[model samples]
Target: MTKQSRLIFRNKIFFRLWMAQSGSSLGDWFNHVALAATTLSLTQSPTAMGLVLLCRDLPQVTLSFLAGPLLDRFSKRLMMYISDLVRALVAIVFIWAALEQQMWAFYTGSVLMGIASSVFGPARNATIPGVVAEKDITEANSWTVATSGVLSVVGAAFGGLVSTVVQPAIAFAVNAFSYIWSAAWILITKWKEVTREQDKEESSSYFAELREGFTLLKENRIIMALICTSVAFAIMSGPYFVMIPVLGDLIYNLGGIGIGLLYVADGLAFILSASLVGRVVGNNVTSAHRWYGWGFVIQAAFFVAFAFSTNVWAGMIFIFLSQLGAGILLTLGMTILQMTVSPEVRGRIFAIDHTVDTGVKQLSLLISGPAISLLGSPIVGMIVGVIGGFAGISWWYVSNRERKNVSQTSEPYQI
Candidate 1:
């Protein structure tokens, strides 16, 4: 990023927000490993692992519809604050569950966290334009991705080692503490939300306002295309939900530690790939889809390689490369929405986008867990790779030919 963009974006408001987000994200991978490893140890069944993911995703998918309207009409920062605190309080359940080896409590905590995350995502994205200039939005988002990537690397390694050496309960406690840390930072961050006069007046009922967001999304060809792009990413990422247990029970057999090693590679790749892609794709909102498609292609290619790996350590390199591509695709997709969408509906749009992302991922997990039990992780991974590869290729083709293709030129719905 340019010095000017950096200076503008790193103002006190966003800096605090970033610090808060980083604190929470630090626990993300740890939570993933802790939950998955414990599930595997407790049940030794892929079916049970699938249930864990279902619990984690169902709330986000179901509640994001409601969260969209709330984000648009309410204070995004305040919503985030409450969400952090709620997550912190509820995360205590994870510690107790880990200590007691209770899957029901573990799933319950996942449900609560998912609800918080559903609100947090759109609220955070919608808050960005308020915190930074339009021109600097991409830079700001890039910085966000870069910082998260860096933290993910350490978080994955530290989380994995701790879960292996110390205990899953310790990781669970860190997750709870991270939420408190996030709540503290967000509590003090300054935010100035810009709203439409109609919104301020509350002229419309809840359903009407929701209809407005839906209509905008339906009429906007560009937005739908961008949203469709997330499908491939969803498929690419779905593996994360199931692979931990698979790696533990079937692959390297190192259990939680093996899964951690996999993510360490993924997290390391996330740092470099996301940072580099952010710089390369900076401010090029129009071309975001092209890079997103290409990133998926790269991700799919290596994911296939990862599926065929002879051992865990060799597979780690492929895992690194696969997530490198993931980092690029997800960063581009998110930056595009932040920079191009209207502020009034950005929250709703983000909600819909996230819903689609998570919904598709959950579907894949539904398929993956059953199939893995039937066929094994390698075969299931190959099948997903094929699906993602085809989807990524088609998306790239359409995006690359935008200027020449008549359908690609269709104007987006005007607000």
Candidate 2:
């Protein structure tokens, strides 16, 4: 590795957290591929497939209001451990559900996994800044984003291959093991116990605390813009989950292999964008925001191209290009959020981000399901592509309008 690449690992705690992130992320994709394939196979209905996706997303939408305050009031480290442990146990149950062909059980397991993940994700995001210097935020986020991307490729391909050749039950078992590995890392890492006196002072009634998170969202113009743009991008990309499997099975007729290849392309792009673009935008909020703007434009263009492509390989290339944009937006957004926020409220902010991203996508998937049935995937893609195009334009306008205000009002973040 290059000297710059080694910099993030210099913080041993950050390194440990990265390892934990790697294990859980790998398991996430493993479960995703296996569960998606299993759901489609069991029900053989597009609506059922969408419903399965809904099960995994619904918790983030509904529970984030509560999860936000809980994360802020408690130990993020403890939360991570508990979340991974629960997910690990749930993965075992997933295997049983798949084996017994109990569709309801499978959905229940997925819902449980989603609940665990909702807590884990915000906790992980909130924890990063606590362990690393401000100077290293970009490098640290790059490492995390790249790691997630690489593992996604591995997990998706492995899950598809195993599900196709051996069995999906095997994939679930692998996921179960990965969660255990993640929890083990968390167990070993020594973390400072956050004193609850500060929390107790800040705490109010549950609804009051929840409203405080929303208050922060309203006050922070930049964060609000980020959330809006993120929602737009998420809605535009919602068809991807539904289309990948449907296109693989119905259009390309390559089944799991086709879906796996597309996922690989997306993952490769994510790795490249996060590692390369991440460093280029380092420590400069303006630069990061600019990249985010361009990323949306790129995604809008590619979404259209992907929809039009007939050949599977050609479509994969389009998917790769689109996800590159996605990677840039996602990584930079996280970095910016971390650098900008006070640690006390970071968890709640990230929780809101998660809620908006997942909730909007959930709503989009609901629409995509029926849209695909009536209008077909390509037409649906075209429609979302147009919406993305408009969103990109709007983001540019909003970003420019807010830029002067944010720069003047923001406090300097120190290492």
Candidate 3:
């Protein structure tokens, strides 16, 4: 592809949307690191750190179902703009509370920000089809994901650096400004509202719409399998994030900077993987499935390697590999969904997928803390990696068999 063709932001709407998302994602990383640090500073308990994370993910667990139907019913652009505004307000509150040394304010702000993310998740996915050409979907996703990953790495490193030099409250204020800037970009974009096609047969009730989304997933075996695999992967991967700080503190003795470095390593790897996806992913469902399977296997093996590492450099290397695998899987999965699913149902389906994925992560996070406490971080990590590897291999075998069966059945009708 030519350089001009590769430029995702050349399209006016996409440029604006990407800018907004990039800025917001950068601020989110800062907010995430700051929250973890603040909790550690105040309570100095791993359990407390886990609880703070739980608070952030709790909305996804509880309200993800609602996100789909709401995205379907409302204008996605409007929803995203409103979510940004809400997050901006919450960030301001966080800044104020952090400055005042009030822990409750930070906690409350985190919860609100979580709610905002819960709403924005489905809307953001659903808006992509509206912004880019169908053929360029994979490339568009890759560019967006790659940019976000780089920004996340930068933001995490910056947060850590800022925390060491400046106060946490000041870091929070900078985060608040980032949110406002992102919101302003979205407002400037003037993205057109996506109107749902008129369908007299479909019900307007939220429960009915949610049921429809679930039914669609049930009917599409491939999509169902993909989602199940995603849940399994989340369960296997979630503990690493929850336990990373503990590993840093107890094992590496690197403190906040170590945590930040871990995030940066993963993000950098993710960006590198995403940047290559367009050339790798082809125009067929089978190709998508193949990429997804390989990605999972690579991720599982990396996780296993990561669990066995003692040195910080070794840890970073393995973590980077794992993130590269994850980026590939995400790119292919999203592209397949966007290409195969009807736009009308895309919002709800994407939301359901995200909800299931996040719910699994939440469950994993809840269990991980205790599991680590009981087994120690290294052993717990090893167990998760082993399980994840088995799951990936099993998924690959079953999915390949299913694909062959599908192809064989269709072969009889070929001219």
Candidate 4:
């Protein structure tokens, strides 16, 4: 692409959206470290940490549909701004609670942040298509994914360093500031709202509008398959993430620094994979599907390797590849959904997608600790890895068959 073409691809609207998401992601890492540290410091229990995570995801499960209607009813930019503002206030409350030594306040703040996230999730996904040209959508999504990956590494590493040098409360306060900064940047952007007229026509009944999204999902076999695949992926992969800290404490003996390093490793891998895949796949569905299948195979293998590694370096290397695979798969999934779904129902579909995915992760977090306690980390890890591997193989086989069927059907009907 020429310089001008490249510049158009990196349009102002795209940059603004990227900035907002990057800021939020940066703050998210800080929030995670602060929350985990606070709970561990105060309660000194792995189960408590898991419970806190559960609280964070419970709202997604309960309020996801509500979020969809709200996103449909309001301007996405406005909703995003509000979400950031709410999270900022939640962070402030957390800072105060930490200062006051109030445990409940911390939990309350965490739940409130979760609510903000629940609201933000659909709005953010819905807003992406508005900011970039149709031809650039895949690249745009890839950049978004890549930016998030880089931020995750930077944020986690920075959070750990800052938390170690100063205090968790201060780290959280910095996170709050990031939200404020993001909101301000969002306010300066002038992207026109792309409202779904289908949604506007049904404004008379919110529940009816919400039901339409679910109805669409119910009727679409491909979408249903995608959602189910995502759910399975979540269930198989989720507990391992929740178990990272526990792994750090029990298996690695690395503490907060160790946890942060593992996260950084994963994030770095994701960034590299996202960047490469974005260029390679571009807007080609066939290429995306092929890479996604291969990525899953690699991801599952890496997870098994990660489970067996005795050294931090070996574990980090495997975890990095696992995340790389995940990043590619996720980018492909999101792009496919966005391209295939109607704008009218996209918000709700994404909301349900996020809700189910997060719900499975939360449920996994709830059981992971006990499972590890009983089965041992290595055994539990092996089980999860095996399941993921089987699922990946199934996904590849099914997708390949579908691709062949589509090609065969299209041949006779070609123009």
Candidate 5:
């Protein structure tokens, strides 16, 4: 770790939260690896596997009704651990699903876990500024992303290994344990959220609070530009991950282990990009825009390459480069959002972000699942990949104009 990053770990609460989430996130990959492998093993259809992803995303869309205001009005800290606990139970349901080979149980567990994650994500993002100094936010997010990269590799590889040698049930069990572990650590992290006067009055009505947040979309061009970039990435994301399994299983003729290795490559991208991504966005927050565009352009190029790859080795290389770009996009995008939004409306803004991101992604999943059967993964992926490049260029241009406009009209935006 660098001297700058040393400060984040120096805060015990942040450290514990970081460690706990790292473990929890790793478990999430295990669940992902297991779910994909199990679904393929049972159904023998890539479309079915894509539907599994759709099931996981549905709650993010459906439950936005409750997630936004609850996040703002309730203790975000409480929401965090409770989400963890709910997911633990959901994991147990997955274990039963694996044992019984019941597809419904798996889908049900996915929807339940999605509901839990919907709350946890905003709560955690909204909670971060409360834990550390504003200046440390970039490095703090880097470590979080980096550690996730490391854990994802471990989780994907080990989850693959367990599914291949032992059973998918074992992987499901690990996910359960990981959630319990995260909940325990989260309880130890003390998060103090101060309610602003505007927050207090708005707390009286959910729609009023929600409407207050959506108003930012019209008022802030930066948020609008970010939303555009987010949608492009969301479009890429739906096909990108869904097709990875198709690449491993059908194209490369690799089995469960192969699927896992493909994800390991993606995880490695995050680990490789995290430090450099942090440095790029460090202190000079405005720098994130150009880099964000470049990240997407790079990812877009390699995504096409990965889609047509003929061998596992080539596929891994393409996937790694593609996701390296994605890692940059993800880190920069998240940090910019965190730095730009205030605590008063942070949850609603993030909820809107998730809703838009997931909504687009779900459509991608809906199309790609069947398209993979018709046009094949490469064509489906290529179409989306080409669009991503344009999105990157357009988003960068818009953001620059928005920044100039905001600088002219208003006070500066900061976390």
Candidate 6:
């Protein structure tokens, strides 16, 4: 590898954190399949599956902002360790619930897992910039995005098989073990403990800290716009998760294993696209913005194609291709946030971002059953495609206007 590529791996702290993140993400997907399969097997209701996702998401919507202040005030490493430990325990709960045939226990475990993840997600994101060199911020994010996608391929595909043949409880047990392993990895990281002196001087109350995060979003037009873009992306892409099983089982007649392949295909595409995006747009803020905006347009195109496809294989191909756009948008958005935001309030900003992004996606999932019932899956895809198209257009307009303003500022004075 080139020196630039080697920089992130060479940094021992970032490398360990990256590996830990990979393991944790792999476990997350594993739990994702296990929980969904187990829930459906027990309740025989899609609504139950929706509720499962909602339980995980509700905490993010409600506590996402609150978690921000705590993340900023506390040590990120400590928060991560605690979060992983809690999630690991929750995973074990799922295993026990599955083995015991207690549906309520499974639901309770899922909710607890969600609550822990709400804290973990923001804390983990907030820690990245501090762990790597300033110049390597974009590269680090690229690697992270790619790592997630690659591991997702492994987690989703194999996790499905394990859940199907061996038993979902076994998959949940594996997931629990993965989180414990992640916590151990975090324990070894040499993060300097964050003292509260800085926070004490900066803010007086928890509410004040929360309000400060809101003000920052209001004051920064670019960041605010990006957040809006993420919301649009979330809404557009969110229903796919709900639809994938329907496509695999009802439409394609391939069942659980087919749904797994669909997820794997998406991940593989994302990994390839993220790598290319990292190489092309590395450290180029302007280029990153341009690519980020264009990515939405690409996503829209693929969504439309996917909606139109009658063949299951064709739909899978489209889903895979669409994630290329997703990969670019996600990688650039994260890199921009890490590079631009002040480290002090970075946790809150990430919290806000995650809250909006995830909350909307979960909300989409919750409403999807009704939406699909009313409009049918094909029409729902079209709706998402239209929304994605509008998002892309607006993003392009905003980004181009910013470019014009910058150009005008740099131009020589007229007579």
lDDT of each: 0.76, 0.81, 0.76, 0.76, 0.83, 0.81
Off by over 4 Å in 3: 1-5, 40-50, 190-194, 197-203, 246-249, 252-261, 282-284, 376-382, 394-415
Model 4 per-residue lDDT tens digits across residues 1-415: 7422373356987777777778878988898888888888889997788788777768878887678866766688888899899999998888887778788887777788888889787788877776666666777777777788888778877887777688888988988998998898889987877665653554457788788788888876557767877876787666567666766656788886677778888878877776777778887777866776666677777877877777677778888888888888788777767776766667888898888888887777667777878977678778777766676677667667766676777543100
Model 5: residues with Cα > 4 Å off, grouped in runs: 1-5, 35-54, 93-107, 196-203, 249-261, 372-382
Judged by lDDT, which candidate is best?
A: 5
Stretches of model 6 off by over 4 angstroms after superposition? 2-5, 192-203, 252-258, 400-415
lDDT of 1 by residue, 1-415 (tens): 6553464455888778877888899977788778787888889987887688778779999999778877887788899999988888777888888788888887787888889989997888888877876666656766776677688768777887888899999988898899899889987676678664464555877777778888987765557667877876787666755775577447777876777678677767876775676567666655566777777778878887887776788788888888888888767777766765888878788888888888988887667766777887677778767866777777766555653454456754221
What is the C-alpha local distance difference test score of candidate 1? 0.76
Model 2 lowest lDDT segment of ten = 193-202
Per-residue lDDT of candidate 6, residues 142-245 (tens digit): 78878888888778778988999899999998899889989998999877644334545555688888888999999766678788999998898667777777
Give the runs in model 1 whose Cα sits over 4 Å from its true position: 1-9, 33-53, 93-107, 160-170, 199-202, 240-258, 312-314, 372-382, 397-415
Off by over 4 Å in 2: 37-53, 98-104, 193-203, 245-257, 376-379, 406-415
In candidate 5, what residue range of length 10 has the lowest lDDT sum?
194-203
Question: Model 4: how large is the Cα RMSD against the reference?
Answer: 3.4
Clashing pairs in 5: none
User: Each candidate's TM vs. the true structure?
Assistant: 0.83, 0.89, 0.88, 0.88, 0.88, 0.90
Candidate 3, residue 394: how far the Cα is off, in Å: 4.6
lDDT (Cα, tens digit) per residue for candidate 5, span 47-73: 888788878878887776457777777
Better of 3 and 5 by lDDT: 5
Query: On a 0 to 1 TM-score scale, where does candidate 3 land against the true structure?
Result: 0.88
Per-residue error for 214 in candidate 3, Å, reads 0.7
Error of 2 at 172 (Å): 2.3
Q: Which ten-residue region of model 3 has the weakest summed lDDT?
A: 406-415
